[model samples]
Target: MTDSFQKRLNFDGNIDEVIERAANNYSLGNLKHSELMTVGLQDYNLHIITNQGEYVIKVFSKLRNVENIRRYVEIIKAALNAGVHHPSMLKDMKGEFIHTDEPSGLSMIVLEYIRGKTFYDMDRAPNSKELKLIAAETVKINKIKFKPSYLFDSWAVPNIHWMYKQVNKFLDDEGKNLAKTALSWYEALPIKLLPTCFVQGDIIKTNVVLGENSQIYIIDFAVSNIYPRVQELAVMSSNLMDNKKAPLLRRVERVKQAYLAAGGELTEVELKSLYNYAVCAVAMEFMGSYHERYVIGETADEISYWMQLGRQGLKEGLGEK
Candidate 1:
């Protein structure tokens, strides 16, 4: 979680009132039950069970710019058109997807509640069949036609260098060395030569929901944007290749093959950069976690899990095992 989100969690304001006002915009009967979700890191997700139906009200944090939020909504529309399975956002009374609360100075959007298990909830990696479906959906997502915006997300793969620079000063000696090596590998890749597309930059376990009938639904488009096309594979492989019985390279090959089977085209440059990008993805995650813990004053225990994953991933990427 980022510093802004931490502050939002501690906010003493009446959030129920905010939820009530936001729900008033939609004719969803009356709010019967509402629960604050603990999964997302960027926004305040309130699960509301109204008299009509269940829905999720996502209140944007202060870190989210309104323009970027609009872009996110647009991306979700594009993803749906491209045959990606995900929750749909509902328009308010004014037929607008986003609603801003004047009293709290917060922007929010309501999406249909998806009843399923996330990979986080399941506590397991996607099985072979699930991985193939996820890859196919990712291909569809990459093929969606959307205009690029100047939205800046620190977690984006293309911004790995910049993120390293920002978080370098806060790392200890071991972390500094690990990040430097990973950055070197990232910099050596022919980044400009690779293809670019709108990617779901953060496709970790929590953002993916496994619905009924073996359907896979992707949620949380907060960090989705234009980037090197291979980044989609890189992000997915790094997070999903958790099978202890398989070699790392073999696991990555499974991801690549599934992607290719789904009609995803990859250039030679993209193939070469895939491993490097995956490694750097882990490194970037580490830096972000470090930034939260050291720079943002979050407890080391809060971020220790990510730090351990980062260190282990960097070693695996560097063939230190």
Candidate 2:
């Protein structure tokens, strides 16, 4: 739901109201300093430094309702229980997980602030040991199960034809032709239906934090959903590939080896199919994010960059030139 190039959307509501609510709900002794973080692409995150401790007050978009808010909180709690590194939510005075500001009409959640730095800021990829840790943690996270709500389960089973349609919508004639060719390969995959598990659907580097204790923390499960375990590999492949600057096959091989070494299982066919789907996943994200920005007469450097890499991945996946 967030584009790389899109400007940070801020909350139209008064910051004071949100701060007061957090201060009251979380029992922060006094408000020392409140800073609006411009890093978030989707939500307005306010870093509140109070006399008691630091906290992050996330004001969600109007698109999220009360029920959805509760579901998100539930999923995070479940992930934490399964040993995933993420901040725990702080409940309000009424013992409510979700808080709604009547004036802003936007829902908010306060979380315990963890002192860390995101991978994006570090400007480097995870080493082999770190990769294994990430893979192991992901395996544990998938085991934490929940019944998927109707709205939350759709991403589990992706529709290739629908993706082609979406990709075609924003591309020029030549670009559409390239996408069509790539998607044909994705359509031909014999993807086995694996058991659905809890996945942190978006595992981009920016969403990961390395704590002061050298512990790797995976944050931002806002995109979490029930999906075939292999689907997690699809997203991981995209993250590891890093738009093709890194050695794609080597990185994937190492990651897969580490994952299996950590007691994770994947059939040969499933691995191949997921790598193919990984290309399609990149195309789908391009259409949804940068392409949407492109069609509207905006800068599309990111879209063009990813398209070059995705096209290559698709070709390799299909054994075609």
Which residue runs does candidate 2 get wrong by more than 4 Å? 1-11, 152-157, 240-244, 291-321
lDDT of 1 at 63: 68
Q: Which candidate has the highest TM-score of all?
A: 1
Write one digit per residue (lDDT tens) for candidate 2, span 1-321.
223222332354456766786687667668898877655345667788988999988877555666777777888888877778788888887888787766655678888887887765565667777777788877787777675464542223365565556447656775576567656766676754555667787776667777888787888777777766767767666654363455445556666777788888887677766656666665555444434354433343443444565555544543432
Give the C-alpha miss distance for residue 260 in model 2, angstroms. 1.2
Q: What does candidate 1's lDDT look like per residue over 189-247, in tens digits?
A: 89889999878877777788998767899888777878898787887777665544454
Cα deviation of 313, candidate 2, in Å = 6.6
Candidate 1, residue 311: Cα displacement in angstroms equals 1.5
Model 1 scores worst on lDDT over the 10 consecutive residues at 1-10
